[model samples]
Target: MIVSEGQLIQSGDPLLKVDFKNVKDNVPSIVTPIVFTSLIGREVTLEKSGFQRAGSNNMISIKK
Candidate 1:
């Protein structure tokens, strides 16, 4: 995960940077939690560091 557990995140903070192609292919299933949370508020302390996939796609997960 870009931000570790208990790290405070502020608005405009980068959560994850993804390739447009990969996200375009899997938009229905992909979810960016940090980005969403930032949109609703100015900051948040992460409860989990979440997960990240290795290799080309590099998918990130917050809860699952």
Candidate 2:
């Protein structure tokens, strides 16, 4: 899904594709309770943020 039929992709172009088969459909909901319990009370702060450029596009980068 990263590139369209006629689209171009270059080096470092971020491409992520996820396939959801029936076997994997319930994974998130099953794991959410266990994961959320540890994060019930917490403070998260984003410390650094910037953009990385490739070709004519700028992609945002964030760090904790």
Candidate 3:
């Protein structure tokens, strides 16, 4: 799962951001056979990073 409570992540940034098209449209981009995230155990500092939020996103569901 995406870790949104680290040292770098913010409120509106891409916490669990993922696109299915990246798997379907460009299969070659995925070096692995699974849909697991490879960003774990890494340090990311977004203090000076310039990124844009996606315009539209699918409805999200949070299970407690």
Candidate 4:
């Protein structure tokens, strides 16, 4: 994971890094949802600490 548990993450924070150069197109379709689900789960945890989705950039930010 790019960020550790309980780490303060801001908008555009790098969450994960995956190698797609050798990956097939079909693989991304299968993996995308799983990655998003994992991110949403993390967002749930952050929500408890006042984090929220920021606009349509698929980023999370601490609520003002």
Candidate 5:
């Protein structure tokens, strides 16, 4: 979500992305909670403007 079609999102960036389809309006509570756990204690940077590929991430790598 951070890096869209032409934005530059390089490796080693501290970020995470999710792709949700067919959201039934009652699943955010169930699905988002666990997904956010991975981001706990991490820093997030929001772009005021950018375009990135629209889809869910295929893999996530965390460094301890």
Candidate 6:
């Protein structure tokens, strides 16, 4: 990894990279969601935080 004080970076600039083509016979990179989700379960529920209802007025922004 590269760290800079105030340097700017473009789109294709490389920070760090490694080659694993030969080692793929033993292990392979993960490229699927099904295999990944089966390893880890969901962590949260959307309703737990409760819904946001409009204020006094019908508009989303309330009047003072």
TM-score of each: 0.34, 0.24, 0.21, 0.41, 0.20, 0.26
Residues 1-64, model 6: lDDT tens digits: 5636456775446644445465565567523221222224444323323343423222121122
Off by more than 4 A, model 2 = 19-64
lDDT of 5 at 39: 74
Clashes of each: 0, 0, 0, 0, 5, 0
**Considering every candidate listed, which one attains the maximal lDDT?**
1
**Candidate 3 local lDDT, residue 9:** 66
For 1-64, candidate 2 gives per-residue lDDT tens digits of 7767656777577655555465377575422111222343564443333433335333322233
Query: How large is the C-alpha RMSD of every model relative to the true structure?
Result: 13.1, 13.4, 13.3, 8.9, 11.7, 16.8
Rank by TM-score (best first): 4, 1, 6, 2, 3, 5
Report lDDT per candidate: 0.55, 0.45, 0.47, 0.50, 0.47, 0.39
Q: Select the stronger candidate by TM-score from 1 and 5.
A: 1
lDDT of 5 by residue, 1-64 (tens): 5555545666556455554454545364423432434577665444333333545353344544
| Model 4 local distance difference test score | 0.50
User: Candidate 1, residues 1-64: lDDT per residue as tens digits?
Assistant: 5887778887557766678688879777665553444335344445445565543232433341
> Candidate 3's residue-wise lDDT over 9-63, tens digit each?
6446655556767676867563433232455665443332233355534223222
**Cα error, candidate 1, residue 19 (Å):** 1.9
lDDT of 4 at 53: 40
Scored by lDDT, model 1 comes in at 0.55
| Candidate 5 error regions (>4 Å) | 14-16, 19-64
lDDT by residue for model 4 over 25-51, one digit each (tens)?
536442443232334333332223233
Which pairs of residues collide in candidate 5? 3-52, 4-51, 4-52, 5-51, 5-52
> What's model 6's lDDT at 12?
46
